[model samples]
Target: MRHYFNDLPKTALTAGYWLFVAYLLLPLTLMMSMSFKDANFIAFPIQDWTLRWYAEVLQDRQFLDAIAYSAFIAFATTVCATVIGVWIALVVATEGIFGRAAIFALACLPAVVPGLINAISMRIFIRVIDLPTGTAAIILAHTVHAVPFVVIMALTRLRSMPKNLTDAARDLGADPFIAFVRVTIPYLMPALLGGMIFCVLTSIDDFVRTFFLGGYKPTLPMLIFAKVQGGMSPQINAMATIVLIATALIGLYAEYLTRRARK
Candidate 1:
């Protein structure tokens, strides 16, 4: 009786965790199932199953274009965010930097700002600067949103780095630039990889900022939003499933790389 009571809380917590997992995965599982449904409409029965929708989605020219455009934007955002983020992280991590806290806070501000508000502000800022809404504008917005994550990751890694590594590099007669490139950069690789992956994911998944800053060209999310306006269909589910799988794979691959880099 005593043992049973002692284990009760643990059992309950374990059960709750699985329930939460089920809650999250149930919708995704249902959506994936619908992608295979032969019927055009989304429904529960799903008596007929087929790959027609997936095939159609694959043949979709607009879908292809949107995905490609989104990819390009994500790539650009990741590069810009990574460069700027590393610089900020380095500056903040270095000793004797003035207002380090404020600099770090400002760099990370965009992440805490509400997405809609950020989007609205970005839209206005671009207009004020006479920057037209297009791929460049979208990339700029995404970079702002993504830079904070990189700063956080990189800064965390910098804080944990051993001081001797850089000291030893300097003692060996390596210049500051060479020490940073060869010693500091290698140490920061895991964090940089993780941050870059996060940036790519967030940029690709972004909708609000893209919606506000987009020109005539539509991203994948915009394409999906446009389709949803017409109504739900198996094709949309198929497209979503493909995206989910691709992103999941990318995340797993990144995890593997980070672990390897750490080793």
Candidate 2:
């Protein structure tokens, strides 16, 4: 009877875990299913499935352009965010730095700020600085939004790192810069790579900030949003499914790389 009671909790947890997985995956499954629908419009009963939507989406010039543009912005944002984040993490990790806690908090604040608010504030800030709304502005906004995540990841890795690694390098007649480049950077690679992946994902998915700062050229999210305004269709679903699959692949690849780095 006691074993049955103990097993009851385990069974419940197992059930709950599957249920949570279903909750997360069911919607995505439905969305993917819809992309294969034969009809132009979105509907259930997907009795007639076709690859026409996917075929058309692949041939779309606008879609291709948006994908390329978003990829560019994501790359730029990742580079900027990664550099700034690593710098901030180093500063916070250093001893005898003034207001280290405050600096860390401020660096991470943009992450917690509401997206709409951040977008609006960034719009105002750009205008105040006379920075025209375009690719530069969009990259700037994404960099700001992405920096905090990089900081947190890099900082966590930094804190867990042993001091002896760098000390050993220093004792071997290596200067601070050399030690940092050789020892510190290699140790921080997994974290930096993970952060860069996250930055890419977030920047690509960002719509609000991009919408506000975008000029004539449209990003992938912006293009998706514009299509959604027209109405939902299997084509749109196909586009979304393509993006979802691409991002998922990127995330999985990052996980593989991080695990490999640890080993």
* Tens-digit lDDT track of model 1 for 1-263: 78768899888898899999999999999999999998867787988889999999999999999999999999999999999999999999999989999999999999999999999999999999999999999999999999999999999999999999999999999999999999999999999999999999999999999999999999999999999999998899999999999999999999999999888
**Against the unseen true structure, what C-alpha lDDT does each candidate score?**
0.96, 0.95
- lDDT, candidate 2, equals 0.95
lDDT at position 93, candidate 2: 97
Where does candidate 2 stray beyond 4 Å?
Answer: 1-6
Candidate 2 lDDT at 58 equals 94
Instruction: Identify the leading candidate in terms of TM-score.
Output: 1
TM-score of every model versus the real structure? 0.97, 0.95
Clashing pairs in 1: none
Task: State the lDDT of candidate 2 residue by residue for 141-226, as single tens digits.
Answer: 99999999999999999999999999999999999999999999999999999999999999999999999999999999999999
